[model samples]
Each structure stands twice: as structure tokens, then as C-alpha cells.
Target: MNRKTLVLPAVVGLLAPVLAACGGSDSGSSGGDAIVVGTTDTFTQLKTRPAPLDPAYAYDVGTWNVLRQTVQTLMAYPKGDGAPQPDAAQSCGFTDSGNERYACTLRKDLKFSDGTPVTADDVKFSMERALTIKDPEGVFALLSTIDTIETKGDRQVIFHLKTADATFPFKLSTPVAGILNPKDYEKDKLREGFSIDASGPYTLKAEVKDKSMVKAVFTKNPNYKGLLDVKNDKVELESFPSADAMGEALSKGDIDVMARAMTPDQIDKLSAKTNGDINLVEMPGLEIRYLGFNTEADSVKNKAVRQAMAQVINRGQLVSEVYGTQAEPLYSMVAATVTGHSNAFLNKYGDPSVSKAKTRLTEAGITTPVKLTMHYTTDHYGAATKKEFEVLQKQLNASGLFDVSIKGYRWQEDDYKTKEQKGQFDVYGMGWFPDFPDADNYISPFLDKDNTLNTPYVSNKIRNQLLPQSRREADRLSAAKDLTEIQDIVAEDVPLLPLWQGKQYIAARDDITGSEWAINSSSTLQLWELGRGVKG
Candidate 1:
């Protein structure tokens, strides 16, 4: 459980509008060595771990980002861009009726690494199996908007949609939508298998449990043909136990690059020590830190109670002292880089005002000395979290109006997210990195009644139908306008409070290049494009 959202120092200016990118990576020069990448994702039990490295359960973005390189999809992204373009498919489109229809034509020369030809059945099986899984990590959830999956001839896949959603293709470009082999689970039961059954750039070599994970050399499929959004033929990943630990490793020249978070102290040290051969690259992150109030809790159920509590929150003090000055103030439910973000809450509430908060509480006929519990994840967000919430406790308690208790989880485990998503605690903090680069990513997860994020949120008009409708619109820019309206409603409702956004900090050895992050609203990193220079 964490309370504040992480905002970046650089993206306060770039969070608006859209930028079109060519859908795939341009070819880059190849090198002799495997590029070791570092990250702090050791805890989350990859639901799809060691399972053919398929996309059926690539629910977590970090997990999916890894799978994307190992498994090729029907289409890939444009160079330096985020939108999709055809690759394996000659072209795909909906039926003129616009309902009960979608079709795709497969590339002429395409085969899985196993030499099995890529066909329409593969696509159909990949999707149908997901829908059959009752709950498939989130693949089904993405395509749940779909009504039916059908195939025409040996090369065409038909998707019958439940609604005229324009974002389906964008959703398809996701790794969760990656195609898989039918024979792996051809028996109808999704039994686990560790063999390579993909048509990707690289194949899995080994998975080290909880400590490190490494991918073998990537090789172009001699007969392999599929869409790609990257330039490199083969890539490798070496995972570290934690970001802080990874930073130490990168500095020791143990790894080629660092592609994850860093301790605030490590970042400060890296910023000052240029001659040490480490490069510290900073970018706006899609993850935000925020405190969610369990609106269903009697003490917090009332709008006045929630509002009163929010007003006394001293965001500025917390960022400076606890975050090591690595944060900024946030006023929107969505982060700065996300589309449709607005400072509606700032406009309405101004700053932390104990007097005003107390007045509201009194006027509502409620007393202070309220008891509250806040949940946080100890491992995922780093050491700054405990202090972050402690700062929150100090602010709320000093108002002479509330009593606060804090709880913690060990990253994705502690099942803290489930509790927070289920709306179990009085108040909890979470750091959300977007699933994709749309503003809908912010509003959709938190506001969707089905998403379990409405935990502290009761079913409301805007969240129920309006947000979904916005997501259905094909035009993301237009959808952004609708999502902004939903943001205002959420901020006014106080279902969740906006806190701060995070910046991505990577501490890489100077020889590594192309670790540049996508300015995506989701802040996705294209690890496939990174390479190592000859050892200097």
C-alpha cells in the first residue's frame, strides 16, 4: 500500500495531446554481445512465468514488455512512435456493417520458430482460449469487449465486436494480444509447457526464480515472418532483484544497462558523479502516487469527511522532505503525461487548509479524531514510501481532527492491490503505471465498475457509462476530451485524491545507448532497441 502517485519532473509540459509515431523501429547496427538490462521486478509472481513465454497472461506491463520481444505479434509499432501498423497481416478491417466483423490476411511467408506455419487458427485459438479461461490474467479482459471470434479461409481472422470500439486495434497491438501456439494447449486444458512455440525475435533460454531472468541470443527467423516495432533481430534481458540493487550492479559494470527505478539516493549520487561511467536518464513516468480513501468506510463515507481529510494533506512538505525533492504536486486523477489530465482538484480545493477542512466537517455535523488506516507496498515503490505516509499521518493528526495508522505490503504480493482494488481498507496508497499511452488508461482502470478500481468508488453515473463510452470512441484525441470530463467528475467526487507523478530513472554504464523511453502516456520502454558497444 502506498499513498502518493509518482509524477516526473520533465513531463509537466509534455502530458497534453498526441504524437504520431511510425509503427516500428528502424533497423539499427548489430553488435557482438548480449545486452544485459536491469529492473526491480522480482516479487510479482509472473502468472505466465515460464509458460512458453506466451501472451495469454501478460497482464503486468513490465511482464508484457518482456514478452513482446520474445513473441512477435500480427503488427508492430512505427519507429519512435506508438501507433500500430500492419506486419504479419496484409491489412485488417471491419465489415461494412461495422458489427459482427473483423478480418485479417496473414503474410505469405511466416512460420513459428518451430517451423509451423502461422495461420488464422493460431489467432483464433489464442483469442478463444483467452475467453475460455474465465479469468485469464487480463487477456480476456482486454478482448472481453469482443463478442465472437471466427476465421475465414486459412489466412483470415474475424472478430465480432460487441460495440463499435475504435480502440480495439490499439488494444490488439498490446502484448496480451500476442498470438500463441494451439498445440501448447491444444488438449483444451491450459497445461504448462516450457518449450519455444513463438514466432518472435528471440526465444527463452532460462528463467531464474526471484533473483534474475535471462533471455538467450535473438536470431531472425530464417522462415520466420511477423510484424515488429523494433530494429534488433535478437535481444536479451538480465533481471536484477531490485532497482536499488540493480543500480549498484550497473555501477560495478556488472550489467550493460539499467532500465528501471533507482533509490533517490542513488539517483542523487549518479547525477553528481559523471566520471563513474554511469548515465542517469530521466523521463516522465505514467505511474502516479495517490492516497485513496475508502469512501465506504463509515468515517470516510460522507463526502464532507473525505473532503475534510484531503484538505489538510500537505503535499508540498511531503515531496520536499520524504521524496528527496524528486516529486511535484499533482491535481488530476490522471498523471501529467496522460491525455485529458486537468488540475480541476487544484482549482476547487486550493491548498492544504486545516481550518477550511474543519469547517466542512463541522458543517456536515461530523466530529474529528477520526481513525484511519493507510496501506502501502514496501518493496515496489522503494524506501521513500514509509516516510511518505508518515508525513501524511503527521499532517492529518496535527489538524487535531484525525488519527492515522499505516500498513504495508511487499510489492505486488501482500495482495495489497487486491485489497485496495476491492476497497477493503480505510485509505491506501498505490503507484499505477499505465497499461497503454491513453488517458483512458487512467480513467478506465480506476473508474470502470468492472475493473475493481472503483473500490472506494460506488457506482456513479460518469464512471459507469460515460467513461466506457469515451473508451469506445476510436479517436483517442476525442476520447481524451471525454476522459477529461470524467477526471473533473472524479476530482469533485473525491473518490481518490491526486498526489504526484514519478520520473523513470535508469543508471546505465556509459557504453549502452538507445535506452531512451517512449514519451508514451504509459511510459513504455522499448528494451528491444537497446544494444551494447564493444567493451572499451
Candidate 2:
């Protein structure tokens, strides 16, 4: 799923003082009170597809945050760093030596939000429907490894893969593998409306919508029998019109917590202890921002044009001038914190040079002052997105070899369908929040034949040879060589340019507990970990 951009302090030392000052041990076992959490992330309901809450159609962070509470997957991520633990399954493992065939045994007497029993047939049905429907905006691409799913009796489910894929277990830990009740969902179509029937810690009580989702209400599920402990009785997720509105809701005592939508200025003020009643918590994030070029567009179709643009843009100046201390320049599509990261882009392009950029364009016999259009989402990311694009336009126009125009569109209403999916722009900005914490997750989705970018980037070496070799290795770290080669190939092809990576931050009133644990490493909100506590 893609994430909305949020900024945090780049230096880790700056958070030490703030963490020490806001010290109180929260066991997530406090007062069972209802809390209102506010964010700027909104949802859209399309006429041709199902609602955003359906597991088959949701591919954004905002909708998955809600689904994490209502839909249970076979395996789940622990609070920090570790292997995935069983949630709905009692035991699961690869049955073959080649990591191709996997099997799981369901826990005895598991029930959904309704009183229906959860069987192995329902698990098989849920996965098959997602792959069969193949929603254009969905995460079915993550399930491309499975060749078949088989159910044995009523308690066991087995998966047969086309090839050896070591990352299949991690994929099952994501929300895309969420098990659905067979009776509530169609066999080959997305379930309409916002209602869901699943076995998780919380249930969807109600939703408020106005063209897009405005608010959602979640309560404790009576029939939920899972491995997680539910700490809160109820939670109200409210979507504010803007970042300022969300921050004001926290200040006015209307909302108990503010998650992932604060502007850089707001974050700075909070970090300086301007608000005595609020506390800020920072977590390590794997979020990244990059620019994708339309390979078929007339202006950027030539590989030399994309390579020249990559060489001319200055990442250091962009981060310092616009983002202040909130972000760091990224040199690889795989984030620096990941296992197999390298400075492939930095090694290829070095520092920004206008002379080198001009020489590359001239050698290709391309015309001077190349015309291109750059597009970005106006409302989805944050207020700084507009300024970010403005700085990009200034830099490109100053290079004297390119003519650039910048445009902004609202994400839900205009940008997603009309602009991005249709490839209406020469170059566009996009953000990625990883589906799982793996280097393969970073490389495959953008460069594969059927990619999420909606642009064709056909790299036969990457899709056929390198990717297959990497997936066959059981130890993921041993596949670093193949992953490094993939990054170097991307640097040469220049299908996308890596820009900056961000850290995660959350702010809440003093009475609210578990703000630190609400969002996991994969950026999914675990609402069951939140509760109200005594005021300091």
C-alpha cells in the first residue's frame, strides 16, 4: 500500500530529550474508554469497484489502517522486529524442501464478527476471489506466487506455488491475505459497501461518507478469537479536511490522538514543547518518495532524456531547502535502513551537474530545452507537496536543457483515475510504504512487467532472471547480490528516480496511551494497542 507523506526530525539524537520528558510506562492495559483519533487521510468509493474497506480493493495506507483491526490474516507482524507469528492459524510451515508448497492448520472454533464458523474453505475462497477479480487498484500483484490453493477437510489449507518463493510467508502477513467469510463475499467480484465480516480484534460498527469517507467507528468484537489482546473498548477514526484541522482537534480536546498527517511546522512546534498537554512519539519508518517517468510519453520516451533529468536534479539542495531537517536524501529505491541497500544512483550520477546533463542530451541527438509536464497530488500527501514540486520546477528550468511545467491534482477526485492510471503526465511524484520489510518488495512492484506505476518498464533481466534467482534463496540476506544488481540496473534504465525517505511521527494528548505502539513497522495501525490513561 502507498503512504501519505509525513515528515519527522531527521536526526535521531533530537528525539532523546523529548522521549525522556514524556516518560510514562503504558502497558496498554488502562481505562477502557472510547477515544477519537484524527488524520488527514481520506477514502474514495468508486462506481466501478467496491468500497475502500474491502480487503480485495484497498491498496492505500488509510483504508488498510482500518482493515488491520477488522480483518485477520494467517500470520501477523510482532510489535518490533522478528519473524511473523500466527494469528488465525495454529501452525504453518513450508511442507517441501524447495519452499514451494506451504500448509497451515486453523485454530479450533474460530468465529467471525457474526456467529459464523471460520473454515479452511473460507480461507481458500478469500484468496481465490482476490486473484480472480484482479482489481486494477488492488494488491493482487503481491499474490502472484500462488498457482493454486487447496483445502483439506475443514481445518487445513495448503498453497501450491509455481516456483520457489521464500517471501511468500511475509506476503501472507499483509492485509491483502486477509481471510473473509465465504457467505458475505462474492466468488469473483468485490463486495460492495463498507460492511465487513471477519475475525479480528475489532469490528466495523459504522461509517460516515460524503463522496469520500469522512469518519469510521470501530468497537470490540464479541466473536473475535485471535492471538492479539484488545486494550481499548472503542475507537473513532475521524478524517479532517487538512493538517491544520487535525492539529486543532488535538489542541481543543476534541480528539485524543493525531496520527501521520502533521505538517513540518506543526511537528517542530510540538517538538519544542509549545503544547504542554500533548506528547510526541517518533518511530523508525520505511516510507519513500520518488518520481516515475512515463516510458511511452513523447517527451520522456527516450532513455537519455530520463537519465539526463536524473543527473541534473540536486537531492541535497531539495531536502535542505524545502524539507528542513525532516527528511534525508535517498540514493537507492531500496531504503537505506533495509537489508540490501546501495548507493546505485549516487554512484552513477554523482552530484548534480548541468554540463553533464547537457552533454548526455546532445549525444542522443535530442532537441534542446526538452518539454515535459510534472504532476503531484495536492491534498493527499501534505501541505509541503506543493512547495516540493515548486522547488523541482525551479531546479529543472534552471538547468537550461529542460522546459518543465508543474501541476497539482486532488488524489481521490482527479489525480488517481484521470492522470496517473492513464499516464497523462511526462513525470509524476509517488510515495511507497512497503507491503513487507524486504528488499524484494522495494524492487519488484515498480520494475515488473505488470507494475503499480501504470507505466510499462519491461526489464527482462530483472523480471525473469534476477528476481527468480533471489526468490529461490531461503535466507534473504544471501540474496543481497542479486538485489544489488537489480538496483544498478534500475540506475542505468532510469525508469524512476529515488528522491527522499521519511520517518514516522505521532502526537497525542497526555491522557492517551499506546501512541508508540499503535502503528507497527509496516505502517499498519493496530488500534487494539491504544487506551486511555491517567493524566500526568
lDDT of each: 0.63, 0.80
Best by TM-score: 2
Error of 2 at 349 (Å): 0.6
Residue-by-residue lDDT tens digits, candidate 2, 1-536: 11222222211122211231253346455346678899888876766544677787788778788888899988876654346778899988999999999999999998888879999998998888889988777488888889999999988999999889998888888777999988888878877777878998788865656556677788888887767878888998888989999998898999988886789888778777733768887666778889998898889999999999899999999988777777889999998777778899999999999999999999999998999889999887788888998898899999999899998888777745346767787799988888887888888888765567767778899999999899998787788899999999989999999999876777877777777767754566777777887676
The local lDDT score (0 to 100) that residue 234 gets in candidate 1 is 52
- The digit string of per-residue lDDT tens for model 1 on 1-536 reads 10112332222444322111111122234555666776665423434333424456445556565666566666666533455667667787666454346677888766777888888888878777766763423445666678888788778887888766665666677765667767665524443433346776666655554523443334544555655444445555565656667777776777766665567777777656535455565644567888777777886888887888768887778788776556777888677665567787777788889989889889988877787787888766676788788888888999998888888886544556556655677777877676655666666566564453546475467755776677566555666667767777776678788788766655556555454442234546566556555322
- TM-score against native, each model: 0.84, 0.94
lDDT of 1: 0.63
The 10 consecutive residues of candidate 1 with the worst lDDT sum are 17-26
- Total backbone clashes of model 2? 0
